[model samples]
Target: MAVEELVGPAPKGWKYKTLGEACKDGGGDIQTGPFGSQLHASDYVPVGVPSIMPQNIGDNRIIEDGIARITPEDARRLSRYLVRRGDIVYSRRGNVERRALVGHHEDGWLCGTGCIRVRLGENGADPRYASYYLGHPVVREWIVRHAHGATMPNLNTSILAACPFLEPPLAEQRAIAHILGTLDDKIELNRKQNETLEAMARALFKAWFVDFEPVRAKMEGRWRRGENLPGLPAHLYDLFPDRLVESELGEIPEGWEVISVDTEFDITMGQSPPGSTYNDIGEGLPFYQGRADFEFRFPKRRVFCTAPTRLAKIGDTLVSVRAPVGDINMALEDCAIGRGVAAVRHKTGSRSYTYHFMSSISDVFARFDAEGTVFGSIGKKDFHSISHIKPPRDLVLTYEKLAANLDDEVEKNEQESRTLAALRDNLLPKLISGELRVKDAEAFLKERGL
Candidate 1:
C-alpha cells in the first residue's frame, strides 16, 4: 500500500507498513526489574546514579528530580535491568499507567520494581517513533482494557508485547518523529523561560522582604533622602528608613507589627456535600478539592453539584490544610472547594499580595505541620496563632501595587501555557494515529507560521 493509504490521502506516493512488520522483530520485549524487598533502604546513597521509578515517568518525558540513588554494589546487581538512552519506560501497575520514551540524557538510568523497561532492537524501527505510538490514546486504551486486578490495575509482560501499532516506512517514521520533536522542543523552551521569569521574581521578593537587604540598607542610613535604591524606583525612597521596634514576636523593622492572620483575613474551609446529594447529571457548580485541584495554571477535575456553598472568587488563594501543608494556589474561576482546602479572602489590599505573602512563608507552615498516623494536617488554630509581621499601611499598599503588576505578568504566561498545552494535546492523538497525515501537519504548521 502507498504511504497515503496508510496515513490517509497523500500528495506523493510513499510505502506503507504495519508497526509489527516494519520492525525486524515486532516491538521490544519487556523485562521486569527486581523487587524493592531485594535491596535494603540503607543501601540507598546520596548523589549516586539515579534509580528510576513509576513516579519518575512524567507526561512525554522522564523526570529525574525525586529519583533515589543506589551504591555501586547495588548497581552491579541490577546491571542487567539498567535503562539505555533509547529505551521506553512504562509504569506496569498504577491507577494511571504513565509511559515515557527515554531520551539521550537518560542513558545510564536504572529502573525500580514498579516500572518495566523495554529495549528496542536495532531494526530500522526508531524508539522515538514507537514511544509516540505507545503514548497514543489508542495504545493507552488497549492497555487499560487488558490491565488486570481490581484494586490496582496492572499490565503483564504478555499483554504489553501484544499491543498493536500502525507504522509507516522508515523515512516517514523519521519525518514524523522530527516534526513532533520540534513542537516538544518549543514547548520545553517556553516552560524553561517561564521558570526563569518566576525565579527572578522570587529572588526580588526575597531581597525586598525575606532577606531585608533593602530595609537593612535604609536602616544603615546609606541611602540618600532624594536618591532611589539600586533596583527600586525613586518613588520607593519615601517609604525607607523604616522604624525598628520590638513586638510580641520579636524585634521587627519599624512600622511593622505582629498580627494574627485570621484578624487580617477571613478564613473558610470547604465542605463535601453528602453523596446522596451529589448529581453528576444535573447542572452544577465546579467543585475543587485540596492540592489535587491545583495544576500549573488551573484546576484539573471539577466535581458537579446542583447546590454549592463556599464559593472561592477569582484571584482568591486556596491553601491546603491537610495531606500537603503549605501548598498554595490561586483561583482562576468561581468554584467550590472541598473539606481539606482553606480559602483566604484578604481584608485589605490586593488579594494577589496575600498569595505571594503566603507562598513566601511556606517553610514556616511546614515547621508547624502536625504528623498523623495516616496523614499530616495543620491545625487552623495553631496556624492563626503564628505571628506574621505586617508592614505599615503605606508600605503594604506599595508592595501590593508591585505585586499586582507581577501577578498580571504571571497570569499572562499561565494563559499562554494553557493555550499551548491544549494545542499539543489536541494534535498528539491525531498525529500518532495517522488520522491526520504528516503533509497535512506540515501545511498546518506553515499556515500558522510555526
Candidate 2:
C-alpha cells in the first residue's frame, strides 16, 4: 500500500522514508528478538532480569505484571536482545499493531521470543516523537493491513523496517512529543489515583463487613465510648453491635442477618440483539458484550446497537456471567448489554455499595467457573443464590455516605482524563503532519492552562 494514500504527502521540509532507511541514516538497526530455540521455557526464573513478551506490551508502555524473568546469566547470554531506553518493541505475532517504547526502568531487559526491537540511530528521529507517530490510527491501520499470517497476524524485522516513517525537524518533533506526553502524564496520574481510591474502598469493605473488625474490637474491649482508634472513631462506635452471635455465616454482629444477593439488589441478565443491528458507528445505545468491554471502572463504548434487546441503566454494576465469570465494571451511561453480562444495582439505589460488594465476592463467582461444563456460566438462579450478611440499613447508608464521596472524586478525575485524551488525539495527527504548527498548539494549551 502507498504511504501517501493513507497519510497524504509529507509537509514541506518533512521527509518520508522506510523505517530501515531512517535507522541506517543515523547508525541504528532493526532486529528480531531471541529465537525460541535460543531461549527455552525452562530458562525462566522467579526473580531476575525481566524478559518482555507479547503480553507485556501495552499502549506505548510495558506492563510489568505477570512478566516472565530470566536469570542474570541467561540475560547475559542473550545480551544482543537487550532493549535500551528509546528503543521500540513490537509483538512478533498477534496484535501486530501494538508496540511499546522502552524506558529507563527497562534498560537491559531482554526482548524475549516472539518480539522485535527497533533502535533508532542516535542522530536520527526523536524516539518519543516516532513512538507517537507510529501510534497514529493511520499508521496502525497500515501495519495491520500489511501483517502476514492467516490465523494470527505476524510481524518481523523486515516488515517493520519497511514501514513508512515520517520525519520532521528534531526540535519540532520534541515539541509535538512534549504536548502529547503532558496529556498522557495527567491521564496516568488519574489512573493511579483511581487505583488507590479503589483499593481504599475495598479495604474499608473488608474491614467493616467481611472481617467484622469493629464488632470484634468491641467484643475484645479494644474499642471504648468517647475514645478513638485507627479507622474507627469514638462517635461511630455505637453504630456497630457490641456482641457477636452464631449465624449461618458463622460469628457475626448480633443484629445482622444473612440475605441472598437478589434480595439486596435488582438483577438484569442481558439478551443479545440480532447481529444485523450492531454497528461500530454510533446508532443507538453503546453495547457491551462482557469483560472484553471493561476498563478500570467503566465499560468502553465500542459496539452500538440500533435495536438493543436488554438495557442497563447508568450507574448499574455490570458483572460478567459467562466463561471466566465475575469481572466487573459499571455502566457510565444507559447502554445495551449482551448475553454474557448481567446488570446489578442495589435496591436502595446505592451504587457505591453495590460495586464494592460485588467486588468483594470473587470467591463466590469462582465456584461457578470451576464447577460448570467445559465453558463456565452462571444463570440467574445460581447468581441470586449467593448469600451475603445484611448489616442494618442505617449502617449501610452510613458506609454509602462516606464511600460515595470518594467514588465521586474518582468519576471527576476520569471525566477530566477523557476530555484531555480526546484533545490530545485530535491534536496528534495535525501536529505530526505539520497541519497544526507547534507554536499554535503551544498557544492553545497555554490558553487552557494545560
Candidate 3:
C-alpha cells in the first residue's frame, strides 16, 4: 500500500506533503547556512560556539570530533544559521544524502558552511520521524537525483523544499520513531563502548612497544623482580631487558632487532580484478578497495567480486597504501582486496600484535602520503622494506595474550552493534511507511529487551 494511504475503516489522518509545506504548517522554514563571504576560515577560534560543518554530520547524529568553532560574536552575527533542537542538517555538497538531526546538545550551534537546515514547527510532523523518513532509501535517492552539480551534487533550499514527506498523526509519528530509536540507542551505545575498548588497547600497545616503558622502568629501578608496576605485571618481569639500544629508527629496547616489515610479517599487496566482475549484490566474496571501505576496526561490507584476485584472510590487518596512507582496519572475514590496500599478518599468527603494531606506526606510513607530489602511494617494495623494531617472540606473545582479551570484547560489541543496526534498518521503512503497525513493532522490540 502507498505510505500515505489510510488503513482500516477509518482514515489514519496521514497526508502526503512537500517538506516545505509541512515545515510551513509547523511554523518552521528551510534555509541554507552562512555563505563563505559571511564566515571566513580565519574567523574560526580555538574554543567557542561549535559550527556544524558537513564533516560533523553522521548517520542521524552530529559528530563533534574535529568540529569547527566560531567566536560567540561570530555566532551572534550569523544567528539565522544557528540550528535549534529538532532541526535537520544536510550537507550542501558531495554526499548530500547523508544528514544529521540536531538534538538538545547541538541547539544554538551554527549550521556552518556547506550545509542546509530544515526546521519543522512543533505542530507539524515529528522532527524525529521526519529525519527517518528522509533517510528512507527512496527519499535519499530522490535527493541525490535532484541535487545540482555534475561532479559533486549539491543540495539547496529549493531542492530540499520539494522533498516528499509523509505526515501521520503526531502521536503515531512519535510511536514509530520510538520503536526504531530504541534499536538505534543500543547500536550507538555499542559504538561508544567499542571506542573506549579500542582506545585502551591502543594505549597499551603504544606504551609497551613504542615507548619501551617496561625496560625504562627496570632501568630506573622502579620495577623490581617479582613485583608489578602499573601495567607491568610481576609474572612478566623476565620478559623485558633493562636497557635501551640505539637503532636506525631511534632508541629501542635491548635484545630487540631492527628488521624490515617483510621479515616478521607476510605482506600481500592487493590486486584488483576487472571492474566488470565487481557487484554490490554480494554474488561472491566481499571486496574492499581502500579507506572508503574501512570503519572503526573492520571493513564494512559494500562491494563484492565474482572473480577474486588478492585476498585478505580473516583477522589480517588491512592498510591503505594509496592516495592517503596509514588508515587501518582488520578484515572480519576472508575478503577480496583491491590495489589500494595491503594485507599484513604476523608470521607467528598473532592477530592482536599485528593489528596494534600497524596502528602504532601510522606516522611512518603517513610520511609516504605526504612526500608524494600528487596522490600518495606505497608500492610493494617500499611497503615491505619499511623498518620496524621486533621484540622477542615471547614478549610479543605475552602482550598479545593481554591485548587480545580486550580486543575480543571490542569484537563482540562491534558484532552486536552491526546486528542492532541491521534490525533498525529493517524496521525503519516498515514503521515509517505504516507497513508494520507501530504497536506491533514496539512489542517486538520489547520482547528482545531493546
Candidate 4:
C-alpha cells in the first residue's frame, strides 16, 4: 500500500525518510543480540543483572519476574549488548512487531540472546517519538513486509534499517510523543494500581477463608467469643464460628462444609457453535476458544459467533479445560465460548468470591487432566467432582462485599486503558504524518487533562 493511503500525507515542510537514513541523521545505532554462544545459558546467575529476552517484553515494558539473570561479571563481559535508558528493544524472532523502550528502570540491563536493541541518536528523532512510530499500525505493516524468515518471521538490522519512516520536524516529533506518552503513563499507572488492588483482595480471601483466621484467633485466645477481631466489625466477625470441625477434606472452620463444585455453584461446559457461524466483525457476542484469549483477568476480543451454543454471564469465572488448562479469566460481559473453556457462576450471587476461589483451585484441574500431545482436556464429570471447603454462606457474602469494590475498580481500570489505547491508535498515524499539527494535538492533550 502507498504510504499516503495508509498513514495520510505529511504537511509541506515534512520530509520522507528511511529508517536507516533517519537513524544515521540522528546519531542512532541498531543491533541484534549476541548469539547464544556469546551469552551462554551457563553464564546466568541466580541473583544479579538481568538479561532481557523476548519473554520479558510485555505490556510495552519489561516483565522482570521469571526473566533470566547473569552475574555482574558476565554482564560486563557482554557490555556491548547492554541496553540503556531510552533505547528500544525488539524481539528478533517469532514476533518482529513486539518491542519495548528501555526506561530508567531498565537502564544498563543486558539485552538477552534473542532480542534487538536500538539506541536513537540525540539529533534525529525523539526516542519516545520513534518508539511510538514503531508501534503505529502503518509503520508496523511496513515492518511486517520487510521482515525476513517467512517460517517464523524474523528481524535483522539490515531489514529493519531499510523500513520506511516519516520525519516530521524535531519539535513536532516531541509534541506527538508527549501527547501519546501521557496516555501511556496513565495506562501503566492503572495497571500497577490494579495489581496492588488484586493482591489485597487475594490476601483478604486467604486470611478469611483458606487460613480461617477468625477460628485460629479464638483457638489461640487472641479473640474472645463476643469481641470483634482487630480488623473486622463485631457483626462481621460474629459470622465466623470460633472453632474448627473435621471434614472429609481437612479441618475447616466450624459451620463450613466440604462440597463438590456443582453443588455450590453453576457450571456451563462450553459447546462450540457451528463453524459457519463464527465471525470476526462482532457478529453477535464476543467469543473465546480458551485461555489463550485471556488478557490478565479478562479476555481479549478475538472472535464472535452468530450462533452461540453456550454462553457466560458477566462476572462469571471462565476456566480453560483443554491443554495448558486451569488458566482463568472473569467474564467482563456476557460472551460466547467454545468447548475448550467452561463458564462458572456462583449460586449465591457472589461472583467475585467464585472468581477468586476458582482461581485458587484451577491448579488442581491442570495437573490431573493433562493429556494428548496438543489437546489435553478434562471431562464434565471430573470437573463437577472437584471438591473444596466452602466458607459459611454469611462469611462468603461478607467477603464479597469487602472484595466487590476492588474487583469493580480493576474492571474500570481495564476499560479505561482500552479507551486510552483506542485514542492512541486513532491519533498515531495522524500525528506522525503531520495531518494533525503539533498545536492541535497539544490542545487535545490539554483538554484531556494530560
- Candidate 2 vs candidate 3: the lDDT winner is 2
lDDT of each: 0.70, 0.89, 0.89, 0.84
lDDT of 4 by residue, 338-438 (tens): 99999998889888898888878866876655655666688799889998987778778888998999999999999999899888888887888777877
Q: 425, model 1: CA deviation in Å?
A: 2.7
Q: Whose TM-score is greatest here?
A: 3
Q: Candidate 1 at 102: error in angstroms?
A: 2.5
Determine the C-alpha RMSD for candidate 2 after optimal superposition of all C-alphas.
Answer: 2.4
Error of 3 at 335 (Å): 0.3
Residue 367 lDDT in candidate 3: 92
Higher TM-score: candidate 1 or 3?
3
- Put the candidates in TM-score order, highest first: 3, 2, 4, 1
Per-residue accuracy of model 2 over 331-350 as CA lDDT, tens digit each: 88999999999999988888
Could you list the CA RMSD of all candidates, in the order they appear? 4.2, 2.4, 2.6, 2.7
**Candidate 2 ranges with C-alpha deviation above 4 Å:** 1-6, 37-48, 245-250, 371-373
**Residue pairs in steric clash, candidate 2?**
none
User: Is 1 or 4 the stronger prediction by TM-score?
Assistant: 4
Error of 1 at 366 (Å): 2.7
Q: Give the backbone clash total of model 4.
A: 2
Which stretch of 10 consecutive residues in model 1 shows the poorest summed lDDT?
Answer: 2-11
Shift of residue 223 alpha carbon in model 2, Å: 1.6
Number of the top lDDT candidate = 2
